[model samples]
Target: DVRTTFKRMAMNDEETVALTAGGHTVGKCHGNGDASILGPKPEEADVEEQGFGWKNTQGKGHSEDTVSSGLEGAWSSKPDRWNHTYFHLLLNHEWESVKSPAGAWQWEPINMKEEDKPLDAHIPGVRRNPIMTDADMALKMDPEYRKISERFHNDPEYFGEVFARAWFKLTHRDLGPKSRYLGPDVPKEDLIWQDPLPTVDYTLSEVEIEDLKKKLLNSGLSQTELINTAWDSARTFRGSDYRGGANGARIRLAPQKDWVGNEPERLQKVLAKLEEIQQGLDKKVSIADLIVLGGSAAIEKAAENAGVKIKVPFSPGRGDATDEMTDAESFNDLEPIHDGFRNWVKKDYVVKPEELLLDRTQLMGLTAPEMTVLMGGMRVLGTNHGGAKHGVFTDKVGALTNDFFVNLTDMSYDWKPASDSHYNIVERKTGETKWTATRVDLVFGSNSILRSYAEVYAQDDNKEKFVKDFVKAWVKVMDADRFDVKK
Candidate 1:
């Protein structure tokens, strides 16, 4: 549990060891009293105690009588000082399992001298044996952790340095790129997990942007091809960790370029053309900006074909990151096995496809209505993975339209089961398949809340509203990880 939890937080073994030991060095656990007498949690307590939780009425209810984690005693002999006493006591002594007054199992040093024990927090002239929890003991017992523990014991200076860096990472990692960090205390060096990007060397004028868009459209790539490549590049963003987005242009790097969900062959073709266009221009433009620009241009063209004539918002200044800036191995966890937005599932899973869709949507920080609009728009724009026609409900496949929601809510078609993951929409009168569908496609019209959103797009007057909402959602996904670009 300790190893896995730390790994997800982007900590390595050495950092994990430093953080755990350094954190426990000064704090003493309080479990000297019976835990059964504790009051209800703050939220569940009476009106008077609403903001205060776990009140203990026994004795003074604090100090010597306090109970937390049901374990007692400190890890270091000199508990108030910043020293290597934790490493000293852990390595020098033999320990035995013992229970605190609260009945929780913990480890205590056996046959220890009186002077080596920690002084009681509240009582003068009283000393108690130092204690260790199961997690603390694991550092001494686990072979890999034991080696790191021994190193810290030998060199206190290196141990302190490592612990400080690890502490900084644990606190500031979710704050996005170091560019967003203000104040003088922020560190000078950039870490790989920060997903750092180079400063934008040049800015493009509006005329230059329009010229590049024209070149991208004339590069012989279809509207679906341009949009899908950009979507695939941007879809890896996780608002949770503030990592993986189009700003780094990491889609061209290893792991991501080679991901099966990205459709590598098609990706290479789009990138090749985009790079070629980039080489011909006199002004410098990052492939990161071009990729997003291509998508926006394609979206505008699609909306124009549908008679909406609205512009898809575009923002430039995204910088391309090199392979050295990327942690290739760490990115394996970010790969999409299933992307419900593009209507692709890499393999079968026990969970329903619609549920997987919701999971991905929430991770991208999108609301339910935004998810619905993006889904309907992607289907009509023919951006389904592998050119799978499962959800391409419109005859005008390359145009941005509300035809997906319209056909979905239309009563003339009967949906039949093609397989567990698929459904076929057949005409009720003639019994001929008009279009194929996936559970992800049918879900919007089937679920009550989603169906309500779907019905709004399906109405005659909301076609322009559908196009505008889809463009808004598309921009949100594209810029989800652009922390360097100011809001």
Candidate 2:
């Protein structure tokens, strides 16, 4: 199966190694896969000892069964979360191939103590410790793989970035269509219609926009979360998953007022306010456009209050879904797996979030550029991967600046491990830290394609440019399902 695992998944050599290293973040091999050659844990064995790989068992449970499968030592010290520590252990320390009691060949740590080991415990099991499977050792078995492992070991940010994309490749798909609707049929140009983008007829006056902004900002709900719900509701109207968006079908729908992301009445609160705001305003513009337009406007106001420059866009054709088109099933189908705040899987997630991020993103039809911008902007707005107010956004809780992207790539804040995968950006002066980066955040900083935008936005003078680019990406998501194109 190793022959086809990477090939079938269409992972390039680099991705193969990165994923191999990253995947061992948690969960131990309980000798269920294959039990042949058996050996002791790394703590009990000599530092330089290698265990028996193919020992002759006189009459084990099975005739041809060897007692060991080289899987014993926990691969990482931090076994609860996703982190580059797998690479760190594989590259920085010595690991000897040992056979597990179940006859599996695995690598064990040479000089590690249970109390002192780095671990990642966020895996599914009660206390899943990291262990290097034979597949994982393949990274070192091949010289090229080892080189990449060392690179990732030394560069956590880069490791996280590569791991995120590779993890996406591993869980969700094989080599398939990049976009659901290809060029010519859907035409990239048609998907992106900015030439005559709609303008608001009954636009909120600056004061009204400000009032709505204050209501939203004080409500403890993220604008990104609100926009995402509206986006999903807009996309789910026609049911084939494509229609009902180009003409703004779901923007004004009451059905989208509550979804998975809008928990505890977050979207409800926003909707309630919008209902109040809509009462006084004329019916020229739609709530969908208002949400998007007001969101960007509020961000502009926040930035201005922070003495930041921004050029926000105004797109107005978003109309509300007239009837109750969306149902409970639609909400379930549209629930977001990859949270944008914590930049990693939510702790409460029953499944891997990476698997869902790319799938959901592709289904919604946002490109890499748009995804990158959305993620980056969300991080600054305290809405990147997982949780809100994890202190990374503690400093600038509501400001929609590019400081997250800039600080990450600029290395202004020294990132240190909070667990294995998460880290806090330490403030150099008072030793105070708040901003943290998840594997997903690393993608925006380390991925070659994504990094270009991060680098551009890191510049001091590109403030407005960053904001404009963020809006462009945000608009793509907001407007993705608006058109009534042929599915």
Candidate 3:
């Protein structure tokens, strides 16, 4: 029956022609190893009778040498014959064990007739069966089995858990065999083993812990709930075999905000003091001396007052007086004294001390005594004098003592020659020192020292105080045993 169905479905017009030429036909009946041709016959006779017999013969003689040789040769002649034989073989093995009521060889029908008795009742070896066995039913009904099966078969989330659990067991071989079995108390959701318990020896203060809890609560987390959940998670991870105990727990404090504002203010104050000191000496001292003694406190005050920044150069003392003066030129020239005053003002004043000598012969353009007077005044005034040695009045008074004036009127009324001389006087006002020896000779007669003294003393109201202090200090030197006033 299978072969007849297959052949009808597989047959083509060209295949039919080949089968006819090879001495096979749609209706012909042939024995094993026999070839005979016949014409088309009635549909029922060709299909129901001849086709059915052909399928039966092919199924029973599939391994016979004679049947195999004949079929191969016929199949080559008609290509459809090979397909028909293959289909028949497939159907034959499926139906061979089927039985009939009479115990006769017969093909099983697709559908049973209404008059036919139930096949199981008539067939002695036939029996009805359930879909699954008792053992299979019991396993399916078991809660554990159902849970595992459902986990793998239905829920992808549960399937991932199972896979992870199995993967962990396989990889961590050191955990021992007892770790594999899932205990009754074990949560179905937490099937995988986690990383080992962290060796946490760090601790936090109770206040810090409470503050952390408050922060978490402020961030929309329930403090107690989160702690309970965390504890459960930690316990689940550690499990019953954990031996490290509560000593292994750790708590971390939150990071504090950094406070770096105004950290440099202390150093800034020191620098300000140094700048104040520096600015104060700008004009009074050489740039080299200013730098050497410019302390931090002085600089800081100067910088604050001037509203400007000041910095000391790395090299302070590598230049000549000219270089030092040039560097300090920008500062205000308000200082009362400076180291280089004489050299700085020499071009504007007298240069040589000997220029003060009085000789009538050398006085061509000017009187010789007048030249001496001008030089003597300059010496007293400290003009063009360098250092502390050049500006002393004792030396000038000693030099002028040679020309003594002896009054003929009264010996007591006689004055010293240097005191009578117009050149032996000095005048200082403001920040400049001037020698008035020449001016005194021209404006006030050299013979009248009273008029010059009266004019200067009237101009400077404090002149008497200056004279007293100067005389008091000078008398100490003049009164020394080494000096003779008469000389």
Candidate 4:
């Protein structure tokens, strides 16, 4: 249970042991009284209690009578001071299961010397056996943890250093890149989990950007390929932790490059061409920037084809991250198991596809309208995963048009389930399949909330609004992780 919890925090085994050991080195757990007499929690407490709860009524509520987690005693001899006594007693003594005064199951040192026992918090010169929770005992019981425990016990200095670093990571991990850190006390060293990217010394001009765009458009790559590659890179961003995004261009690195959802074959081909173009240029341009620029250029081309002349915004500061900067194992969680924007689900899930779409949309910090427009635009641009024609609702594929919403809200077609995850859009009269869709696509028409958004885009007057909103949403995803750029 402890291991699984640590894994969710993106912590390694060594980090996990260090954090737990370091935390327990000081501070004793309080369980002096029977916990059953404790009152409700602070939020649930009565108004007369003045927002304080866990009021122990069995005895004096203060000091020795307090009951919290109900796991009594300190893990170390010096409960108030930081020391190496935690591993010292943990590795040297045998422990047996015992009930705390509050009736919580805990482990206490068996026949431990009185001198080694920690003094009680309230009483003077009265010593008590050091205690350990099941979580603590697991350290010595597990083979791998025992080895680390022995190592820490033998080397206090090494243990201190490891714990210090682990604690720093646990606190600052959600801050995203080192650039986001403020104040004079921030550490100078870069951590791998920060998703480091090389700082670009040179910036590209509009002329230079235009020239690069021209090169990409004439490089024999299709609009779909360019757009998909860029989307895959940027779509990894999660607003929750600010961990993944286009800023590092880590999509070119391991784990991400090999991710099944990225369509590795197509990705490699696009990267090869982008790298070739980068090598030929005198000015330095990151592959990260090229990937996004290629997509912007593709969207612009696609928009022009649809009779709407527009320029998709492009930002050129994104840096290409090397494999060394990426944590490949930890990144497995960020993989696109179900990407509604691309109308792809890697595998069948118990959760409906439409729910998965909402989860992703919220993570990327997109509104319902933005999500709707992006899906509609992605369909017509032919960016579906593996070219699955599941959500391509437009006859004029490769063009940025409102055809997805137009055809989706059109009453002439009937949606029939082809299978659990697939649906066929058949002509009402002819009974001929005109287009195919996933729950992601049909949800816009079937769900009342989403259908309202779809109908707005389907209107003739709102065609231009759909394209503009799609471009705005597309740029939002591409630059989601660009913390260096001020909003």
Best-fitting candidate, scored by TM-score: 4
Every model's TM-score: 0.93, 0.47, 0.13, 0.94
lDDT of 4 at 118: 91
Clashing pairs in 1: none
Tens-digit lDDT string for candidate 1 (1-487): 7888888787888998999999999989989988888999889888888679889887889888889889999999889888789988998999999999989999999998899899998899899999998888888998999999999999999999999989988989888788878998887888997878888879787888889889989999999999998999999988887888899899999989999999999999999999998899899799999999999999999999999998777888899999999988778888998999899989989988899999999989999999999999999999989999998999998899999999999999999999987999999999999999999999998899999999999999999999999999999999888765555
- CA deviation > 4 Å runs, candidate 3: 1-455, 458-487
Q: TM-score rank, highest first? A: 4, 1, 2, 3
Better of 3 and 4 by lDDT: 4
Candidate 4, superposed: residue stretches over 4 Å from native:
32-55
Query: What is the per-residue lDDT of model 3 for residues 108-200, given as tens digits with 9 covering 90 to 100?
Result: 324322222121222244322101112222223445444443333345344444444444433442231232335595334321122122222
lDDT scores for all predictions? 0.91, 0.54, 0.26, 0.90
Which model, 3 or 4, shows the larger TM-score? 4
lDDT order of candidates, best first?
Answer: 1, 4, 2, 3
Model 4: per-residue Cα lDDT over 222-254, one tens digit each: 999999999999999999889998877888888
- Candidate 2 lDDT, tens digit per residue, 435-472? 66555565566568778877877788877777677766
For candidate 1, the TM-score is 0.93
Question: What is the C-alpha local distance difference test score of candidate 4?
Answer: 0.90
Clash count of each predicted structure: 0, 61, 21, 0
Cα RMSD for predicted model 2:
20.1
